[model samples]
Target: MAAYLYESSVEPHAMPGNATASAGRVGDTSPNTLGAFCESPGQPYDGLPCAADSSTCEDRAQECHGRGPLFDKDLAASGELGGYGFASNREVGRRQVAGVREAMGLQGGKGGMRPVRSAHAYVDMGGYEFALANGTRVRTCPAAMGAFSFAGGTTDGPGAFDFVQGDNKTEGEQNPFWELVKVFITPPPSKEQAACQAPKPILLNRGFAHKPYEWAPSTVDVQMFRVGNLVMVIVPGEPTTMAGRRLREAVHARLVSSGIFDEQDDETHVVIVGTANTYTHYATTREEYAVQRYEGASTLFGPHTLEAYIDKYTSMVPFLANGVQGPDWERPQPPSDAPPKEQILKAISMQTDVKFDAAPFRKQFGQALEDVQSEPYRAGETVWARFVGANPRNNLLLEGTFLAVERLDAAGTWVMVKSDSHPSTVYRWQRESTILGTSSVRISWTIGSDTPAGTYRLRYFGDSKSLGGKISAFVGTSGNFTVG
Candidate 1:
């Protein structure tokens, strides 16, 4: 039997008397500003630290785990529900919300806001050649994953086996087993290709592998959006901190030099929006690429990837100018390249369809199996209920929630104060019997300190499929409980 769980949090309400501003300034912040790190020797190896370079403890990558700010907090003792990482996730989200609120408060109104402008183009990155600022000719190789890519993944999601991160070994230094077997998986990198990806030690030459369909993207979207002095660089892949900084700085300088923004009076802001139009993989700085860490190994292209991106983005800056002179001026034409429409249309999925859903004998879908406690709950306490459920995969419920926390208002009406999207709530699913097709869902909400005293109930919404292939929606609500 297979089971699924979905966790969400309660939304934070805005403070009363804080009116919305018409305009505000957008600024860029370093992605590394958050104070958090992956903690090694998690759980089984609790007191030990992973090896510095490989992020492994006792030669096992599974021991390394990412920890949040509240990693030390006991979930049960604190009346919260979730696994090891939930507490930290909650704390990180809270910090981000606080930061956004502060930025909102610093808004100066919409008086100085500029008109919205945008630029877009498609570029084929495979063997893309360009010259650096120093006039040194460079070219990005076809998409390929390096040896470190199989280094047991990253700390966030550790992989099994003997692989570890930062493994930028040369062909001669690599494992003999992998060296012998890699040719069977994908074509071995050619001599020129091997030299192009110098220190990477190619593990998967995806660019050359095109059998059933394309393995990696060859063409990617280069897009940018501008509103007044702020520019958003839409990146096709995840960029490391240093790579993002370098790209932003280069774009900002280009905007100034291209006269899109005045250097003397206007302050230009550039931010990187990653994983925008397509998934090319990760982009890392040259130095980081040399280290061949997880991000660098997954860079797809060679060490010149970031430089190529910077070159492309800056070259398009003039297109973002507010016309050639005034509003009547026309923008320049963008670089032309065909998108990978065939690759998208031919995409395949291995996921199986949900044949049907069936509840236990004498039970109905959405029927309450376990109700909430009758006693009153206090701040920081958790309230939960379980219900007979169906396969959630039947319907994604896009823009809709499967669980909600309703409060009894003064008018005798149930008002939804929280949904599955909230951080304080968790929805867990378990399959009791696969042959019988019986399943259950548990919904829990941990009351926040700021939650007002009132009567509340947990409500679950679901869709079930019948033997005849008909689908129906249902709702289940638990007994009302008081919060004091």
Candidate 2:
């Protein structure tokens, strides 16, 4: 089945702290903190600046490193890269599991089966300083996010067939989609960065920006809790795999040495959970940040980001060693930095008062352009239906329903078999006429090899945009047919 192939191809190996593997049961409540990773960041963004420079940019870039005629010692010291604009601009961080697995002729998603997984280094320097456009110096919380994505950007690059995996050497500012992302992210540097200078731009989540003046603290809180031999380290933002591995090792070693558990005790376990509690941003080994990929660029604390956690967690280990107790540490945080109301766009932006004035040969809103093909369908066959639609924003279909693949049950009632999220199902939306606010929705199911024989049908539910200043809901059905 396509679902099985997709899962088997990407299942993660046993990662330290928590294991990510096979898809199993759903709908489970979370347990309390069994253990935690507690760290308080010392210096804010010490490693945020450019730790190194590209020789090519130094020699070739015009006005590189903040309005320079070249040769500013500050360039290397600040890590402020020019020509490309951002201090560090790397694509998404690497996932060595699948790549390495394929290279060695091993099946994908089997890395966890092998013991002694790879380990990565975590580091943090003191602090960083860089010069601004007006020659004034400023400090920032070292961080980065969403680098030039591989498999094409939102609008630029080849659409679905994009094979270019992306590169750090290439300048992303040249990307056509880069401007579009900026519109949404509103990244600092140049225009707005200069216009507003209170807190560094990194404070905003708009990738590699700033540490706001109102931040709770510069030190990231390293937290931990142990229930029996199970220990959990709660990390702020997303930590890379290598960072997770090192943290797990450090914590597990302490659990054994401190007499919390015997080295041979198979029951002892430690896990590193990210974005678990309070949010400081990302933690990458200094090596990872040095690459300036999306992960490094998004790493906020500083290069020594991982070091900050290791040092703190190592020191705080005694609390959960064997007998240590009491809640004397900070826990993971919920999102409180909710953006202002104005920043969020409402649904009306996507909706128009225009009625469905069908020009010439067009299907009306919510009308089925084509019904499901008559079926004596075999397993592995594909089925779909097309219907007239309005902008989905008019009705998000969240928690509710959109399209469904149903089978006639023994009781003669139609029992739902699949929805859009099913691996075999695809929901395609198209703007047939943006001006008329007319759109189309296509729901499809690729019958898998294991699909059971049945009388099945496709159903589409939509909210039609109206011309009389109201939106109305409608449904279209494929009518029943047999599949075996």
Off by over 4 Å in 1: 1-45, 74-79, 107-113, 325-330
lDDT of 2 by residue, 22-58 (tens): 1111001111111111111353432222112321121
Cα-based lDDT for every prediction: 0.77, 0.49
lDDT of candidate 1 over 377-405, digit per residue (tens)? 99988899999998888888877899999
Compute the lDDT of residue 70 as modeled in candidate 1: 60
Error of 2 at 295 (Å): 3.5
Query: Model 1 clash pairs?
Result: 8-422, 9-421, 9-422, 9-423, 9-424, 10-422, 10-423, 10-424, 23-110
